[model samples]
Every structure is written in C-alpha cells, then in structure tokens.
Target: MRKSRKLAVLTGVGLAPCLVLGLSTTPASAHGWVTNPASRQAQCATGTVQCGDIKWEPQSVEGPKGLKDCAGGNARFADLRDDSKGWKVTNVGSSTTFNWKLTVQHATSTWQYFVGSTKVAEFNDGGARPAPNVSHNVNFKGITGKQKVLAVWNIADTANAFYACIDVNIGG
Candidate 1:
C-alpha cells in the first residue's frame, strides 16, 4: 500500500507540468478599436459606457465581411446595435479625425466608414501590414446631424473584418 501511494504521488507530480502547459496564459490579443470618436466597444473598454463581456475586450469584435450591422454581426456584441443606449456623441465638423489603436497588428486591405448605406470615407492600405496605431481624417462634408458611423477594417490576407460603431453629431 505504501508503494502504491508513492507511485500515485509520483504520477501526480509528473502530470503537474503537463496540466500547467495545457493552460493558456497568453492574453487575448484584444486586437483593435476606434478611440477618437469613441466606438461603442471603445467606450466600454475605457469605462465610459457600461456593457457586457465586450467591455473586457473591446478590440476583438470581428466577423465575416459585408455585414452592415452596428455590432459587426456579432451577437455577443449586440448591445452596440441599440441606438438608445445613450452612447455619448462626439461633435465634429465636416471632417473629423478617427484613430485606431491596434494591440495586434494585421495586414489591412482598406478602412471604410459608413452612414447607413452611404460610404462616406475610405482609406486603402494597399495590402500592407498596418501600423500598431492608425488614424484617418474622415470627410462627411455634405452630411449633417446626429449619425451612427459604422467603421470597418478589412483584413488584407483574411476574410474577416473588424467593426466599430461611433455615434457622432456632425455639423456642416
């Protein structure tokens, strides 16, 4: 019985390292999100807005291409689709600067911003890997009033895209 107990203890000790190795300690990439105008996810990450699990990893909102929804077609982030959530609006001129903070850099195809179905601004990356930080001057010259801007980051080498919905009060 003592020998059997010793063997069991040794076996448990041998498997301890394997159990630890199987655990993932790497931080979630937590990727990228818009900060300047305060995307829904950004607001959550920064504690300006209260939300669900998205608040913990705002930069990770990703889905397939061609989704026009505010939540980037991610049901886990569906709160972003609520227009009455009282997301603070950033007042801006015809042109405003938007910034993206990328915790995980990826090759980018293009960056596009939209209001409803109308594409207001687009920036092409020419299939190059994006910098850790990206910013763009978005022109909405002819558009005015409070609007929900849908920002999309199209990945160059993948079919996935990240999304951000920014609430803005634009003045002509």
Candidate 2:
C-alpha cells in the first residue's frame, strides 16, 4: 500500500507541469474601436446614449474585413444599425478629424472612411502598428449634408477589421 501511494503521488507531480502548460493563459481578444465623433459603440461606452452589451465593450466591434455594416456584422451589437435610435449628429465643416481609440493596437494595413458607397479617404499604414490614440483628418470633398460615415480599421495580421460609424451634419 505504501509503495502504491508513493507511485501515485509521483505520477501526479510529474503531470502537474503539463497540466499547467496546457492551461496557460491565451492572449486577450479585445481589439479596437473609434471614439471621437461618437461612433454608436463609443456613445454607448460613454453613456452619451443608452445601449446593450456594446455599452460595456465599445472596443469590440470586430468582424471580417470588407463589411459595410456599422456593427461589423456582429449580431451582439446589431443595435448600432438602428438609424432611428436618435444618434447624436456631430456638426463639422467640410473637413474634420476622426480619432480612433484602440484598446489593443494591431498591425494595421489601412484606415478607410466611406460615406455611403463612396470612399472619401484612405490612409495606408503598410502593416505597421498604430498608437493607441490615432487620428485622421479627412476632407469631405464633393460630400455634404447629414451622413453616416463608416470607418474601417484593417488589421494587417488578421482577416478582420474594427468598424465604427459616425453620424455627422456636414456644412450645417
């Protein structure tokens, strides 16, 4: 009985490291989002507007690239697609700066801004990591009036991108 007990303890100790290694923490998944000009998620995060789960995780509007939806097609944040939600419209001139608040900076490929199907501006980062706080000054050339601007942050290392939509009243 003593021999059997000793063997069992030895075996458990030997496997401990393997178990710990397997259970080692993985990298966090939380990514980035836009803040200034109050994207829907940003509005929720700041309590400027009421929202659902996105309110607690404004920086998580991630999904596959090449999507045009405001929520990045994330069903959990579908509330953002509701245009009648009375989203606060930011009054801006013909040109304004858009700021990005990255929760976790990733290697970026490009930053794109779209007003409807027309791309107003694009900045190529060439697979470079951006700072946590980034900003882009965009000119609304040939664009005006109330518009929903879709901002996409393409990650160079992943098949994903972070999305944001800022409602604005331009040249108002």
TM, every model:
0.83, 0.86
> For model 1, where is the 10-residue window of minimal lDDT?
22-31
| Candidate 1 lDDT over residue span 1-172, tens digit each | 9999999999999999988877856655767899888899988888888888789878988989888977778889888888888798999999899999998888899999998899999999988988888999999959999999999999998898999999999992
Model 1 has an lDDT value of: 0.89
lDDT of candidate 2 over 69-158, digit per residue (tens): 999999999988989988999999999999998878899999999999999999999999998899999999968899999999999999
**Alpha-carbon runs more than 4 Å astray in model 1:** 1-28
The local lDDT score (0 to 100) that residue 30 gets in candidate 2 is: 76
Backbone clash count for every predicted candidate, in the order shown = 0, 0
